[model samples]
Target: MPRSQAETPENETNSHAQKALSLDPWEAAYLRFETPEEEIQKFIGRLNRLGAPQWPRDAEIVELFCGRGNGLIALQRLGFTRIEGVDLSPRLLAQFKGSAKCTVADCRRLPFTDRSKDILIVQGGLHHLPALPGDLDQTFSEMQRALRKDGRVMFVEPWRTPFLTFVHLISEIPAVRRISRKMDAFASMTEYEIRTYEQWLGQPELIKKIARAHFVPVHEHVGWGKWNFVGTPR
Candidate 1:
């Protein structure tokens, strides 16, 4: 039998998108990467609105592909103490916040019961998943399934803009690379980062279309060098 649409790798991504498929050791090392503290605060502030009227202090929240559970800490500060994180990397999970639970798993196949979670946060993780053409839908399906009737997802990913595209390209110049190496943040490139970023171009728009087909968009944000979405399952 032919593979189901969910199982097939669609002609979804172009040749350049091939980069989002897998991660190497250095790229794997990159997964344990730290998220800026201010980003965490922003997520909390968004949630404050997301949870408006009632804070949902007891809501069970989870971050898919969470690295080091930095986001879990943000939820804690907002009084949502029942938070969890899931990722494929044990190394990242090991560094998760003290009270948050961490699980090693794929976002396409979450272990949670149907409609068990209240909120889902995907900070900087949306673009790094399976880059194959048809794979993005599977991830979206799982995200919707894991949510309660009112469950929602918030996503923040690096934006694919011409200026940033030029920036990444110029940063690759040998002279620029040498100078960047002097500064730790841009000191080196991860094979994984390079590949997925190439595939991520134009994804924010595509994600919005797919999200609206199955869910409703509470907000669609694009700017600040990134794209963010607050979506609720339909």
Candidate 2:
């Protein structure tokens, strides 16, 4: 039988996006090789520090944009059960659902009830949207509505300035350039959807949005110059 649309890789081109199709076995293996274990550990430790104290006891955790179930697996390893993974890709979600529960849907229009989960995680996923003024606030509000009282949302996003610079400097290498071009990746993106993201680039606008959504910033860490925000719903 022919591969399903969800099983086939689309004509995608981006330096970073190719790494996201964690559903493909060879592609997944390549990304695993590229991933820096030490850096990943440090990032997880940062998340651990911010989340440990506030983590609900065996609470229901929801991971949004859960590409390839990496974060879900990580949380499971960390002793969190009752986890639901949500993603936009059907193949990825299907693969994850084989061993765990997951849903395929948009984050803005979550299917679950309001304040249903104790923890929500968006890892390297939120920044994929068009960065614009007010867009972050909109996303934060939606996340808040999806969380229970005192629920927490953790996001790991590129820090814009440094991240862009780093990618630019390193992407010039022959291999990186080739991979990036093949992946249709750009060094930086300014989405036409929200001009607010343009003006607020590299700023704490994201944090401010979370705060406005009644989420208190409980922790922040800068690793590989990336920003990780850990906040609690008020």
Among all candidates shown, the one with the greatest lDDT = 1
In angstroms, how far off is 44's CA in candidate 2?
4.1
Candidate 1 lDDT, 1-234, residue by residue in tens: 887665555544542244333544554445333344755776667666554336478888898878767678877777777889998876557655568888999887889888899988887776776574456688878888889998878787778777666666675577776555322233243344667666776566676677687678887767746776787898
**Cα lDDT tens digits for candidate 2, 1-234:** 998565555633442365464445533432343233433464457557666545754888888877667667666666666888887777556545335588888776787888888888887666545554455666677788989887887877656666666755675456775666422233222222124444444466645565546678787666664677778887
Each prediction's whole-model lDDT (CA): 0.69, 0.63
Which candidate should be chosen as best, given TM-score against the real structure? 1
Q: What's model 1's lDDT at 190?
A: 35
What's the TM-score of each model vs. the native?
Answer: 0.74, 0.68
